[model samples]
Target: MCTACLIENVKSHMLSRRSLFSGAAATAAMGVAAGALSARPVLAQAKGRVVDLTHAYDSDFPTFDGKPGILYEVDKNFDPDGYHLFKLTIFEHTGTHIDAPLHFAEGGTSVDALPVENLIAPLCIVDISARAAEDPNAVVEPADIEAWVSANGEIPAGACVAMNSGWTARIGNPAWRNLPDGTLAFPGFSKAATDLLAQTGAASIGVDTLSLDPGNSPDFAVHYSWLPSGRFGIEGLANLEQLPASGATIFIGAPKHRGGTGGPARILAMH
Candidate 1:
């Protein structure tokens, strides 16, 4: 039997299922409860993975205000009475962010307009850490994905593919930010891979870097290839090493900034 069927049978016996029909029903029930199967027994038995693909939000964290970086501010509210209150002033593309189609493409869906079903999906983590270490401007190409499939089988549809470049481990380091000509350097996806993913109709693409294109890119072809196709992109992801290549669901808890182009997001991957 297939691995899934075997897993179901094991789960059935563990749950004390007495018949084949009950086994099928148990599998269906387990699928429905997958998102919330973090109780003590399940956690102990299953030990599924959890990857936190969110930046640490703080007052002094670097955020994209307009050009490059901005920090948040706080205030003590004087609403006719002294009280402690706070405020945040950051750009839509700040920190770990989700790029709604409208971010780069005209007449595209905004964050709110995205379908609810698209909010959560499986994950495909491509390890390009070594290549990115050698060349900071390394771009993940279509051949990379093909090779991954050749080794790891097909990348499932409706999955959130995260390119692990280990860039998040270098966020605000000045030495790494400066290039030879006094410019920032980072890695992202090539237009070829972006186009291939768009053709595959993935719900979204993510990267563990500041942007989905090389830092010095002028045209942003990756955006052009994917955004216009109604697929979104997430940038500045963290903790990609904690996830497996596939079979994990991601939940993006982004603020519903109405009429906003893009915004910071809290992403959690559960396997």
Candidate 2:
């Protein structure tokens, strides 16, 4: 063959090889794209999440009467073009709030001072709803804690132990406030239970009720024991019946109010 013809033939062969390799590359790319598309349904189906609790907050929602009022009003004319915006004013410890260490301790940590890691932790939910229903002033004692641990492994350190007293059912009723004697009476932890949890390195204590101690008692021994230990408190929580006894991870977020001893928080749980 002539020199020019030979060079043209070589060029044609190189082009054909390049085309073949390009086709193989495109095929591999399509396979990867198909694999990714196939995994989409699996990822979508695996996303199983639910709310284990709900928080109650409103004027009609019953709270301690003598405490500050939770007020909110529309700022009708304030925004440009008359775009109405709501304004809220209330005490930090208004509804579903966290009681930081400083709530009772003189020099202890406040809401702003609490460690970030302590806000979220494992939850050990104790169910005493039946007992609480029998006696309005029921208190969870150390033996109860031991019983719970025996049934569901150990109560891990750095976990929030929530006492479920079924008191949330009475929240909207006329008898939601203090009992007949004029003193609030509900369910909570006893001194022994509180101290045991504090010593065991519980990150915080939570309850689906108004107080960490039985309402009728003037002495808040449970609160006194837990708060002074620098652990946090989660009160006024609702829907404790939805969670399992010992497998949920709780997430707690309090509003960043400066120098606040306590502040309203949004608490959620995940299994």
Candidate 3:
């Protein structure tokens, strides 16, 4: 422990510390670079106008069942608490919502368990509005998918194939949910069309209507087949008309409640 010996030891310790810190800093910088690369596509997509595809619904929003989908009770008043809030009693399948596989299958993924990658996807809007305008029960048939592919290129893998039935325009009207005879009538996906979507490796199906199948449908064929097969569906989507037939990407902000069969979602579209 002479002075020179001690000084040399201290110098060695300082050099080791510098090396460690340099290595740590390099690792951190590499992590940031990787993160930026992964985020590029989403950030680039945001350059265009973002369209909200969700419908802001309330207790009165139309549902597959004719009951109220949500109920509200004031929990706090602004004058008294300096804030206002309402306790919400919400039904999972109400509003612009997602239908998880568990909605039908015996053993399936719940809303909280839906894959993160599947939630954001390329959007393919099949415009069946002309047919829907003529027939309330008109469905997006297999032919429509064919036409979509004819006009656009292939439906991207893991894309969300949505049926734009012009039905969102009817939301405020009784006809949106039912016909004059009290029978449910609205446009949706035919089983054959969904089968086509599945063949194309699509991840999800969507409808501007209340159900995946036509309102007058007696059998939930699409629901039974599609959900059990591991794909999900979105119902009550809005602003579908604002999107193009292809190229737009949809971001589904699904609810992550445990064991949720489905739940209200904030869906958006970006080019």
Candidate 4:
């Protein structure tokens, strides 16, 4: 065979493999949504790379009400009790946490009642960082979702559509959860965007801020609509910058307390 022909054949074979991989990736991305949670689906995460999306929190972590999210009391000291154990007082919805449907919907699914399949599924990151940088109250609008789909293909069903507004960079700053004048200010999911997500059968939404709605939101529109539909939300997520827009699987280590709205979660994404 001619050298040129050989080179062309190799290139064609590589392209074919690339296309096949992309198609299969999209299929497995929504595997859990179809109730396919076998070992094959478990291995759907590509490259075997994992990223921790949870942020460590303490009493000082930012909150929506400007109050500490947790308090600690030393119940036992090593000097006296042979081992130290601190009795902790923690508030649901603090730190990197999941917000169950009950957070907004009456008689909705509680944190412990969320489906296991929904807790582990495709991870889709929609970035609005540039806009969030300029407007603290920026949100993941429908337009943003459209653009993401245009570039990265469709959002898979049962996916966790996370808004990466670059707010993770402001973790310790006053502007992270509030403006200078004591008003809340942070980026979140706009109602229109969540509407699109719901239409696509998305299981959950996430934000790097304290709430699912933008800080200045008057009605919590996204929360009211999205949660009542039986979907969940995650807030105060960190390290979203380390993940990609698609092809990652999220595992939400949700709180198991019965009747709880939600609590701090340890979330991880494997790509």
Candidate 5:
């Protein structure tokens, strides 16, 4: 099937399955109220191994520019409330997150406005790890994309391209954020590469680092080059090494915060 047709089918399947679940939940609730509840599984378990692409959020997670990380407090405990509930204080951009177009572009789509179709697409991993190991500030260039295309065929339209610089290995360590001289160093996309991906009709771009642009970038050229075209970004991704160069399907489940420029997301990849 064509990429567009496959994407549409996936969307339709997702929506229909969601509706099925919702209906099942409602029926179960009604059954309990009417004393007709039975012990039977209502939904079939999904097949395949699902890989988590998100980083776990906690006080230890790295933040930008010395900013404070997540804070959690028990709002209610089983002793008093018959349930455990916690209150979380976190920034919208904390942990593994998605940056809507509005994150960098003026009057762009907010997190709530981002289409679900855009969040589900073919995943393409462009590995530049060896070069990144030698130079911490290595940026993915247009040549890298060309090399990827040469080996993996064309990057499908509406695909999410993830740059695997092997940076996730530094997560939770001080090296993930700042350097000795206080200059952040990490691999990210160059303006030329961002332009090439945008031209290819990519739905989104992602990186294992904290930002889509290099940590030391004075001007966020990559963000400017892509976000203005209504594309989104995913940052602080984990387990890129587990995904194949192609064929995996990524689903980004970002919080729908009204007018939010960005928000935490639970990204998953199904191979």
Candidate 6:
């Protein structure tokens, strides 16, 4: 099925569940009005706690293949111009960002075309940090997804699966890229794992590393396997260690660039 169809199916299922809950609430309210039960105490709504999952972009931020990182210039300063204004020159894919399907898939959805619902969804973290520590080239495999399912049920449809390989801890260091041998060596998703997640109806797959595919991959098979389905990718994420394996909802605030293959984003997780 096309990406639009997959998203529509997910929306349909969510609406049905919401309707069921709304109906039950309405019945309870009626019972209360009729005095069938004692008056219940009104509970206050809980405030959501949000965690930043994006890295702050700066000149020091790492980039792939020695690409220019970030450039900031003061166009106007308060002392001289009565306004503190600046111009930022940044690559769309710099720092923490969203990789629209068009980044890898020809004729796929651009960053601006992604639906709002798809930008916010249940967050799932698959941690391969221990393994990554042992081998910088370790990849998250299909068996890892199966293990996650075995322990915590199936991943919900339209969820964003983030691979936490603990690489975020090395963000500013040379280890983030690991190019000693002229090949990047950080951990990422294998093609099998990407295929499994796509099959499970994942809306997006993310990583704390620079790319969703491992550093040494020349074909970027994992990106091809997922993005062509109209899904997205998030990379260079920070603070994955602060989030739980499940239950958090992610809000991806990506720049709306028309015809953009990808763009920077402010990713947040609310629990």
The TM-score leader among the candidates is: 3
Local accuracy of candidate 3 as per-residue lDDT tens digits, 133-167: 99999998899999999999898888899999998
* Candidate 4 segments whose C-alpha is farther than 4 A from its true place: 1-45
lDDT (Cα, tens digit) per residue for candidate 1, span 115-226: 7667776677888989988888888899888877888677666767889987777766642344667676788899988778766657888988778887777888888878
**Which candidate has the highest lDDT of all?**
3
Summed backbone clashes in each candidate are 0, 1, 0, 1, 0, 0
lDDT of 5: 0.86
Ten-residue region with minimum lDDT total, candidate 5: 37-46
Clashing pairs in 5: none
Q: What is the lDDT of residue 74 in candidate 5?
A: 98
lDDT of each: 0.76, 0.78, 0.90, 0.89, 0.86, 0.86
Which of the predicted structures, 1 or 4, would earn the higher TM-score when compared with the native?
4
> Where is model 3 more than 4 Å wrong at Cα?
1-47
**TM-score of each candidate structure, all chains considered together:** 0.76, 0.78, 0.86, 0.85, 0.81, 0.82
TM-score winner between 2 and 6, please give it: 6
Q: Which rank order by TM-score, best down to worst?
A: 3, 4, 6, 5, 2, 1
Candidate 2: how many backbone clashes?
Answer: 1
lDDT (10s digit) by residue, model 4, range 229-268: 9999999888899988988888899999999999999999
Q: What is the Å distance of residue 162 in model 2 from its true position?
A: 0.3
Give the per-residue lDDT digits (tens) of candidate 6, residues 1-271.
Answer: 9999999999999999999999999998998876532211111111377889999888778787667777989999999799898898988888999999999998999999987777877888999999999888789999999988888778888889999999988977888987676678888999989888988988998999988998888899988878888999999999999987877888899789799988889999887
Between prediction 1 and prediction 3, which has the larger lDDT? 3
- Residue 66's lDDT in candidate 2: 51
